[model samples]
Target: MGAPRRATLRFTSIAIGVALAIVASPAAAFCRSTTCTGDCPRDADGCKTTGKQLFWPGVCVGVSLQRDGSVNIPIADVRSVVATSFATWSALDCGGAAATISFSQLADVSCHQTEFNTSAPNANIILFQDTQWHYKGVDNTLAKTTVTFDAKTGEILDADIELNHAYNELTVSDTTVVVDLQSVLTHEIGHFIGLDHSPDPDATMFAGYDDGSTNLRTLEADDIAAACAVYPPTRSGKCEPAPRNGLGDACGASAPTTSGGETSGCAIAAAPSNTANRLLSLLGLGLALRVRRRDRFRS
Candidate 1:
C-alpha cells in the first residue's frame, strides 16, 4: 500500500497539535513539511527530512476570499489584508532573483466550507468564521489552514485559510492592533506553501504568535532562506493559478465524497481517472490552544 495520507494541526504558539519531528541541516535552521512519516530519507545537506517535501507544482497559485466578511471587519479590508499577506511572500528576494512563487487573487467566492474536489474544479479559499470556530481550541486559536496535496509527488492541490474571528478578536488596523490579521495570515501562508515551523523563534514560520505584534508581517533571514531553498529562482513551472481541475466558486456540488482507505484527520476521497492510484494528503494547521501576548507595538 502507498503511504497513508494524514493531516497536521498547528497554531501560533509553542505547542503544535500534531507530533511532527523537525529535521534540519547544520547550515539551515528551517524545516520543510514532508509527506512521509519518521525518517525515510535525507538530502545531501540533511536540510530536508524524510518523505517528499510539499510544494505547488506550478509557479503561480490562486486564492479566493469568501464573500461573507468577518463580524467586526469588512470584506474589503479582509481582501486587502489577504493580498498584502500573499504579497509579503511573493515579493521575497532570493539574493537578487525573486522566489519562484506568485499569487493571484481570484473573484470572491460564495462557498465558506473548505474541501477538495477530485472530479471538479476547485479554488484555494480564504474564509472567516465569524459566527463559530468549530475546531478544538476555539478560545486561543486565531486561525486554521487546511492544505491538500498529492501523497506521491507532494504537489499541493488545494489550500484554505479560516480565521477564528468568533472566539478571538481579529483586527486589521495597523495603528490599533489586537491579533494582527496580516501577521496571522502571513504565517498561515507559510504553512499553506510547504514550510513547517522553524527553530528560529523570530522567523515568520515559527510556531508562535505575539498579540499586537507585527513581527511576522515581514520575512526574516531564516524565512527568506527557507523560501529560497524551496522555490529557487531557477525552478521552472508554468504560472498556473487555477486549481487542479480549474477554478471553482462554490463547494456544495463540486466537493467529492470519501472512498477507499482512511487516515487520521484526512479524507480518502476519490481522485480523477488520470490520477487514480495516487493518494491525497490533507493537513490542518492552527491548534488554537494558547496565544502568547507580548508587549504591544504600534506602527
Candidate 2:
C-alpha cells in the first residue's frame, strides 16, 4: 500500500483570525482578509496579528525546494535561483524591499518521518521529492511554518517543509539529457518563497506547469509583495512608495478620517505596522510581475 497521507497542518497566529491549513499541494488556500482573526488578535480593524503579522509585517518571502533523488545542483545554479527569485520580486510598487533565498544542508532523501515535538522550525532549508507516481497530479509542496531564531542569540531549533506525496518521475529525461533542473527547482522555490497558486493562466506561479511556459521566469507583483513583507529592505535603501491611483494618497497612506481623530502615522513610518503592510503588498506585486514576465518571454 502507499504511504499514509499526511494530515493538513494548520497555523494559528494571534494576529490573524482564520486558521491557515497548510495542504500538501502547490496550490494552498489563503485567507482573503487583510485583518487577523480567532485567538489571533487584530488592530482596530479586527485583523489577526500573530505569525502573519510578526514575520510578514509588511512583506513575505518565497523559497524553492531541491528535488529528492536528483543529481545535486551545483552551487552556481543555487546562486542563480536566489538571484532570479529576488529580481522577480524587485519590480513591484509595494514597499521597496529585497527578497532572499537561503539554502539548507539537509536532503529530503532522509525519508525519515519526523514526529511532532517541541522544536524550532527551519525556514532556510527546502526538501524535494517526486509525488507524481503515487499521486498522479501532485507536483511539489511546502510546509506552512517559518524558521525563527532567538532574538538575543540567533539560535535555531526546528523547521518545517510542506509534505509532498508524489516521489517518482521527478528526474526523468526525454532525450538522455537531464530534465531541466532549473525549471523544476524554480517552481518548487516559488512555493518555498510564499507564492500561492496564480489565477493567471500563464504565470510561473500558476497552479499547473506547462512546457510551453518553461521560461516564464519572472515574479508577479503578488510574489514580490509577499517576499518583501517577510524580509523588508533597510531604510537607507528603501524604495520610494508608489502612488495609489484614484486613492489620492501614497501607497501606504491612510484614508482621510472624516471624524478628525488622531492619525497614527503607522502607515507611513518605517515602524512595524506600516512595514508589515508594505511588505505584503510588495510580495504580491513581485509574484504578479514574475508571472507576467514569464508569459511575455514564453510568447
> In order, what lDDT does every prediction score?
0.65, 0.30
Error of 2 at 206 (Å): 2.3
Which stretches in model 1 have alpha-carbon errors above 4 Å? 1-27, 37-48, 252-299
TM-score of each: 0.75, 0.37
RMSD of each: 11.8, 18.8
TM-score of 2: 0.37
- Summarize candidate 1's per-residue lDDT along 94-132 as a digit string, tens digits: 888988998999888888887787787777888888888
Predicted candidate 2 versus true structure: per-residue lDDT over 3-89, tens digit per residue: 211111211131122212223322222211221212333332122234332222223233233333324444445445545534554
Q: Report lDDT (Cα) of residue 286, candidate 2.
A: 33
